[model samples]
Target: MGFVPSQDADKIADTVEPLAERLSEVLGVDIQAQVLVDYTGLVEG
Candidate 1:
């Protein structure tokens, strides 16, 4: 998947909601994310 824009004219929650579950399976971890949030210095475990 790709980055989803922070704001959209249509409600986007439904569009991005499934990514977390799919990514979690692919990444072998509990994956969670949001658009355009400041993740300045976060690191992955």
Candidate 2:
């Protein structure tokens, strides 16, 4: 997932990672999440 303003990336990851872990536990599957901040905005561009 992408966050506007970039700085929120860490905060977003902090929140998401735990949820991903919980989902993995409940589903008995490996759920992974990597929150990357695109400073260059190349993805959007």
Candidate 2 overall Cα lDDT vs. reference?
Answer: 0.69
Question: Number of clashes in every candidate structure?
Answer: 0, 0
Clashes of 2: 0
Kindly list the per-residue Cα lDDT of model 2 for residues 1-45, writing each as its tens digit: 333445676787888888889989999999876665475663654
> Residues 2-31, candidate 1, lDDT per residue (tens digit)?
334557713454566688789899989986
Candidate 1 — worst ten consecutive residues by lDDT sum?
Answer: 36-45
Model 1 segments beyond 4 Å from truth?
1-10, 35-45
Q: What TM-score do all the candidates reach, one by one? A: 0.44, 0.61
> In model 2, where do residues sit more than 4 Å from their true spots?
1-7, 38-45
